[model samples]
Target: MADKAAAQEFDILILGGGSGGYAAALRSVELGFSVGLIEKGKLGGTCLHNGCIPTKALLHSAEIAENAKTASKYGINATFDSIDMTAVNSYKDNIIAGKFRGLQGLIKSKGITVIEGEGKLTSEKTIEVNGETYTGKNIILATGSYSRSLPGLEIGGKVITSDQALKMDTVPKSAVILGGGVIGVEFASVWNSFGVDVTIVEGLPSLVPNEDAAIIKQLERAYKKRGIKFSTGIFFDNVQQNDDGVVVTLADGKKFEADLLLVAVGRGPVTANLGYEEAGLTMDRGFVITNERLHTGVGNVYAVGDIVPGLQLAHRGFQQGIFVAEEIAGLKPVVVDDANIPKVTYCEPEIASVGLTEAKAKDKLGAENVEIQEYNLAGNGKTSILGSSGLIKMVREKDGPIVGVHMIGARIGEQIGEAQLIVNWEAYPEDIASLIHAHPTQNEALGEAAMALAGKPLHG
Candidate 1:
């Protein structure tokens, strides 16, 4: 950095302008710090442009198509029509464009120095972007992540990752998704609802192997009834793709072919060749290793978002960025563990969970000291009206505070705010049951679950 030309300096220089980078910038400026945020891409990174917002928009379209198909079941006489690829793409693009513009405006309003160039960590205190050096009293690395593909497998033509799948104009007649995780299942739900014959292959035994077993069972059952085929407990050995599509071979010598194969295996950290390891920062398989407070132990540098270990979620990135900003300001923000972070899967019969899973609860507490309860959504008026069936499962220490809340049902993701509060605050079941929840709403299901867990059992 000393050998470089005269460079600009700031109180904080944040690399990457994704959820984490931009978030840190906004919060840092709020704390009266001169912040510089560097990015080579759009202001809002993957989440705004590619990952969360756009994918959810696509899923919303899929939901509308499904609802139209089943309108008659609700006594509304409506005919199911075909999905116009052009209109769908137009709608998706518009949502992203609007959000992107708003985010850019927000960043500009914060009076942040937005440097548009590819940035490399030149030293513990400086970032070099396009041959221009920017030094800072404190540095934050939040380069974000990229779609990852399995080794020996290539993405092109008929085989694609989430990036290509999002921009797909025409829905394939049939699709096979590898990895039964959040990304894979969400796309499977969307493609299946669009009338595309869909199948998911996972090496794990359950679709969302991280959730409680009961929730997983309900999801598998729902998918089965929805005519979505899935093969679990088997890993794909290889994939062969041509102009005609791709065939995936399983480790058991079984093969499945589809018009297109989507590899939703997860995202990899974008810490390669950008001088992360070269700058004395510890690296674990390309992820920047940071301490509990997001400190990199390399001078005044820190790491946040997908580049840091734990949950690779956009909101988590936002929270971590804010926390880091506050920490630098001497505010000493509380650290949020990944377990307490709310996790929502936006697929049909959407899933949401916070805090511990049942298995985890039992492991942390004594098995005999963990109490559990499930309230079926059938008892909720809103759920029945929506013709959705699932249950809210709650886990707690015996005669103690609620440790977890998990749910699977239509639009259940919306209920996670209350659930996260319950779990993160360690509220007892009775504490929630004592509160008034509005009637005739899906939210009431959570209250009812709490009631049952409190041993009141007002409704089934």
Candidate 2:
């Protein structure tokens, strides 16, 4: 397809081509809307070009190295050695570029117009890109987010954000990670596997603070066994860069030095310079506020993804994007239940959760009504065979229904599909317990946990 000149019109004009933007564009086009997607950056947005894709590529390299070293225990004798950062980075880049190309092709196949430039919402129905105005019946914002930093700390050579850390050409000898959320734990696992001295400083009481307490404890023990250190319930006092590296000062009057400092606190929405406020939209902090229907304050304007509040996962953006597209197509789509959405942290011994945590369940359903059961991975044959460590936790009301399930273990994120089904359907423990799980598979852990909650457990 050849590039078209300035003048054009679209049925739906989308600003920001990240996960949410692309999702909305494709869905809108499928709904018979002439779509135009305005992207200032790459087609795949931060996820494909930076955040999720590249980080996973780097983490996979760590997983491979660690697996090779432990191959003998899995019935194969193999010796793992050094890591070539050059080769690793090349591999990561190639993967990212390939996926981006695939995404571009998909967008083109959908017959959606792609405008390469910064997009500004001139109004609810008008968007300006590359100095050209494109009018549409409806508008969607899906700019996503960027890594954030604390007050005193800033990004430099030695001090960096996830964006910079993902592209490092050389591995640091030692590193200090300032957060213990999903990003921090994932990076800590990656660096620790690469033979770096890793220390995680978390303001919360435990790592993966949003997860179940049992899961957090399991992860803490596993990370500690792998030589990763943690300083929880503490704060960062100051960080000063020197010739060797950066000196991280804690609020407790202790100092730690590292070759690199990764600030993995969180991400801030990418709504600035997008003309959201000028378009008469309501925003909190940097996030765009939207109703359950994903409608913005501006008439005929909507927002999704990191720009909209709640979970910042890409899949969540995809759902919201599709929902708004269908809603605009006059399908009268059902509202999304935020609590039904599943969340996963892609670290080794990955954490996956859906619905309420134990504390939240108690608060919502009352302590006497809520019940929880846990199945240790140690009792599962599959986990024992793979030498994986973690547990499966289930929360339900007394004879009511299963409301939540949380898991932690190697490749356990994959199991959330089953957990989500049970939770979303509000299935009772008896319902899941009646079904048979394949023997010696990781999914059997879910069945076991459910069975235990049903008052009888075959394993653990």
Candidate 3:
């Protein structure tokens, strides 16, 4: 107690109680360091509130409605004539609130002090929050990100960001999404199932430009079959809201009209006006420059998560937070492998991938050394039973190991858990193919792909 009072603060003071911040706080405390966490809003951050959790809840509702319509083929007759947005919003809010409460409990159990308000980094080892000055030996900047809007398209009323999309009281009759990235596509899947006419305008040549070219083609077909429209290789020029709806103009001089306009171009780090400039930390292209050890140019200071760029994900935040905490405790934790981090986009036919894509693999290992083996879900008994179809592509090096894995299918996001293990472990095709997979499961697609890469396939 004397030592604690003599300190007058904490060993570690972290800003932003997002996924990364909370993880840092908890891990720091567990490692025997007195920790302090400051957050302006909810504990779980954007992913739990506006981003991952709420969007997924809404997507699940869309999926339930879709499944009900197709229930007759499975020997059951069910119909969904109208969607209840009120009920959906209620369900979404309840789940989000419950999760937030759970986060608060977990933080409390770890003995980490959490403060409610924005935290401004005052110096290398101090933060100011809620009219109180907190001193610490180490400070971490984990302030995450917010949805980015176009230059000409302001977000409000009929034109909104994903935050507004999550709590919409009434379902729009039609939606025109700007930017065919993960957010746009996921919303497309959501509103389309809600009987809204959805159109995606992408500045890139293909939807999910970061994905494999083949997977993008498969998604294009699937979305088209579901009555979603795509306007790829076009940019949004303007967004104007009238009494009736919103009208959007494209770079190609085309016009699109919808009840709502969603600017899902991307997100930017929330480092603006948070005293980062006053501290004089290094920043590169709107992202804080941090070393592999998660330290900034300023001593006793570090930055993590979206603020540091490269794979803005909640799990990555957790890992970085843990790493920084362990490092500060003098435990010398193993450096995090960013490549091992998995990414998932929840839509009708979800997209999930870990490690490299075929293009990325070929660039690294040379075309001759790389090989891509694919298994179509149409050939999988489990997928057929589920009335879903897609493909799984595995990237391997010439008799080496699986370097990348990409998947597209209904509920395929769930399968990424195993796919990531194989990629991260650098397991050879023969290594996985030698093992027996349970019969009639979507996971069999992975097994079959491994077999094909091993020069023998059960189903191709």
Candidate 4:
């Protein structure tokens, strides 16, 4: 245990050194404020150490395996012999290590005090760690989240969460993943590419249910083509694990047995026992309730990241962190609407969208006022060359600005930056249609969609 000091003070104190916390620290330091970043584990927290970096690394490895497996289609003489789990794990670990080192270097260079320990809020403006008190003029809560499981489902033996899945030494012969959200589908994609018999059980009507219905349809088709099995709109009734393996029973009495069961229901805020309620922070179902500006209704206190409850994305956390820092610095940053935040699921044939879904757009803007145009990747030169098929759908008001951009295709996540800007800035289709996109690129698909939406069809 470290010594109990009188107290250390800072201009800003951020809890949980994940994407959100770290981003806030960096921005606060740049604003010439003393920052204290506290974390129990690694500096990069879950996203870099366990969540985003590692998972994306696995997804990339899966993509490589898929590419090699289908190299014959590209007229290449190549064979994907087998996935070396050890080598794959090594590759993933290396990427995480490199990023972790870079993050630490950045924090050190910014002169932010990196406090190493678990911190609990002792008051609205103070945190206590290792029996030492630290006070800040302003305190930002960015505790992040953890994987959650269903009731009566014990996580042990062969049943695991993503945190355990990332550390597995051997790939299972078969897996039954519960919950077909972003995490479930991603792991299903990876395991399928690695030669595992994977099945996804989602209680929703479709996989990636939060996405646009059209995008979900395309993703289902792609997954079906890949022979990845999934059961949707059905809840599992029971799960039993024996020494040999695990068996999951659906509500319809259908049974699925696999070497392991992955519970990917979603993540819950890590707000329990953190003294949030004691500090008078308003919370709903464990998530800190904040105003549009992210205020916690307490003096000099604010919350960001997964704990704030909009999108659980690390990038969302990053943006919220910066927003909170700027707000504290009296920058009066414009509040970013959650709907406008870009979301990318890094599954095979990735899904990326910004702003409203078509249904959402119609509901909000009225069906009579909404217009949509979907451009198929089958018509795009680059997608055909890459042996991929997808669609870029644009939703806009009948004669107004584009409200949403939905896409499904290989490497489509890379196009989210422009889509986010377009939606957030309320750019009209004509405004984007006039801009030239590079020839023979997947991104040009967006331009094509915009052109068609703006009353001119180009290679549609």
TM-score of 2: 0.97
> What is the Å distance of residue 407 in model 1 from its true position?
0.3
* Residue-level lDDT tens digits of model 4 in 350-414: 99999989999999989999999999899989888878899899999889999999999989999
Q: Which has the better TM-score: candidate 1, or candidate 2?
A: 1
- Candidate-wise lDDT, in order: 0.92, 0.89, 0.88, 0.92
Error of 1 at 446 (Å): 1.2
What is candidate 2's lDDT per residue for 1-460, written digit by digit as tens?
A: 1234334677788888988899999999888999989999898788888788888898899999999989988888888888899999999999988898899999999899898999888998998887888877888888889999998677897899998898788888999999999999999999988999999999888998988888898999999899999999988888999999999999998888999899999998988888889988998998898888999968899998988888888888888889989999999998877888998888887899998888889999999999999998988888888788789999998889999999999889889999999999999999999998998899988988999999997754
The CA lDDT at 387 in model 4 is: 85
Give one clash count per candidate, in the order shown: 0, 0, 0, 0
lDDT (C-alpha) at residue 289 in model 4: 98
Higher-scoring candidate on lDDT, 1 or 2:
1
RMSD of each: 1.8, 2.0, 1.7, 1.8
Error of 4 at 321 (Å): 0.9
Model 3: CA > 4 A from native? 1-8
TM-scores, in order shown? 0.98, 0.97, 0.97, 0.98
